[model samples]
Target chain A: MDCSFENEIHLEQLMPLIEEYLAQGKPVKFSPRGISMLPMLRQGVDSVILESYKGVPRKYDIPLYRRDDGCFVLHRVVKVGKTYTCIGDNQFNLEHGIRHDQIIAIVTGFYRGTKYYSVNNMGYLLYSRIWHCSRGIRHFCGRCLAGIRRRLR
Target chain B: MKIKDGYIVREVAGTTVVLPTGDDLDLTKMIKLNDTGKFLWQELQQDTDEDRLVAALLREYSVDEATARAGVQRFVNKLKDNGLLI
Candidate 1:
């Protein structure tokens, strides 16, 4: 079966298999194709390991959820009470009132090449915290001065 | 050589995708095994050699010795390059 080729598969067709793997308590690994969680996750570079989400996702946890119209998304939770308020790291708008049932899996860790970083890693925690905390200013500046400086430097 | 542990063969949208459970290997590589690759992967699940692989392929497909040997060699080299074989 060594005749391997690259092919693009729709997420809708792939999500069920991922969910099945997660439900078996197995962490599914794949390279997510999107720019929503950009900087942290690239379109075709970084790979993420996901496990089935158990309960309410806490603040800052990245969960793969489906929108009512059948759109799938991966975003960070900002507010969690009866419902969740999530926004992508690369986007400004807050998506409100997402119920727990809507969430499929939570990112446990990720990799850049062979380097793996856990969600609980101090550096990752700091990065996510700073990114989310500075979202307000970043959104206001429409691309903050600090971010530009960091990129430039 | 044998196929490394933690790799699984799954079909998605008519493509046979390879996913790894082991994190130690490079996670950035997305592997899609073609039909021949899939068959040899099954053969490599256990300890095997080049001759054995070529023989297996010959038995399975209506191909000549040179073709089967070349296919096995190429696939083996690819697996080795990707660290999919131990």
Candidate 2:
């Protein structure tokens, strides 16, 4: 997903509405939670923009899943197979495969503050490749940032 | 709580199912289950206690105690591995 649809929100304010949107079939939203999609999504800053699933996702499309435990995540599909295999752009390890039925939304666009971008466009291609190449370093940085967030929280 | 509580689980056509109620879930993290797993899931909703659940499945499926216990244990292990249970 590219950064395009930005909705300003405080963490406290965003949470309730995100919850409500999920329950109401309203436009889905959430603050990016990790650097998994780093350089594309920023933790605690970039806001996610989701379109309800309209069909099976194609390669490179970002999709969201509602895990049995109820946490939601956004990741890009690396492979479309008997099960969809998704991976974070800036991270190692493929996430567990999810059936097409498990997908809740397709990330049609993204917003980093006020800037918007499209996933299908060239601007996103450059960013995604950079993210893929620097994944090792970015993942290390991401883990450190995660630890800091945990302690601060 | 109601069986579904604040959430709704409804099957939609073409694998693009919907979970229209509750929190915005990160669907990417879910561990996809096969038919056996789905059957075991419904059974969990009916009863989660380990022993009682095993007993019920034993009766319902007309399986021997050993076979039922093994099946229950394997399924429960998978659930735990996926972080679906405490």
Candidate 3:
């Protein structure tokens, strides 16, 4: 496998240090490296401040969790209880039964350019609720866009 | 100039970064360190000047004096801009 990717570390390798900040009750900020949290978060361009997850995650909270296969995911919570159900905004499927232990952090704020927007920010709250509610329309629009691109090719 | 306290060089899965802890985390950008940047960050942890950093780079890597100086200058300027220097 090609390993030319530089300046990027696996989430597992970085978690201990992040946990130290969390344990101190300090928020940790880092750039997420994927498109799974697009629109609100842009890979490399946007960074997020993650707080340590306490108790069960509430609906619409974005969480950073690690899977059994050691892959790390930052997705939005859509359900709660014995286990959580999460789905990325760009994704249509729901990931169910994600235990509390799997969740390491919860995103409280995000930085777009130099500006920081807290989850409690009115715009952010409205965006999350509206986005979650409009998944069907967004998904359909995405399919239409893909089909257009295919036809263009 | 000296590196500020609460800012540390951390390596994870081969990625090196200058991370700020405690009240030092006012910055919005995450600073990723390359190999040379990592070396300089470790050196700057103790108070040192630009020339000393260049000399250290010359000793550590096979780079020549001018290149080392430029590298040191670039790294120091970046830290300075980020308000990471004390």
Of 2 and 3, the candidate ranking higher by lDDT: 3
Q: How many Å off is the CA of A26 in candidate 1? A: 3.8
Question: Which runs in model 1 stand beyond 4 Å of their true positions?
Answer: A5-17, A43-45, A69-71, A81-83, A112-118, A121-123, A140-153, B5-31, B46-55, B62-70
Per-model tally of clashing residue pairs: 12, 16, 0
Cα RMSD, model 1: 5.2
DockQ of each: 0.29, 0.03, 0.21
Question: Per-residue CA lDDT of candidate 2, range A27-69, in tens?
Answer: 5555667687876788766766676677688877888776666
List candidate 3 segments past 4 Å from native. A1-8, A148-153, B1-6, B10-17, B24-39, B42-51, B57-86
Worst 10 residues of 1 chain A by lDDT: A1-10
lDDT of 2 at B39: 52
| Share of reference contacts found in each model | 0.36, 0.04, 0.11
Q: In candidate 3, what are the lDDT values of residues A1-153, reduced to their tens digit?
A: 010113455567677667777887877787888788778889878988888888778999999999888888999998888999998887888899899899888998999877989999999999998998999898899899999999999
TM-score, candidate number 2: 0.46
Chain A, candidate 3, TM-score of 0.87
lDDT winner among the candidates? 1
Q: State every prediction's TM-score relative to the real structure.
A: 0.69, 0.46, 0.76
lDDT string, candidate 1, A21-73, tens digits: 77778787767788888889887678888887887789999998999999988
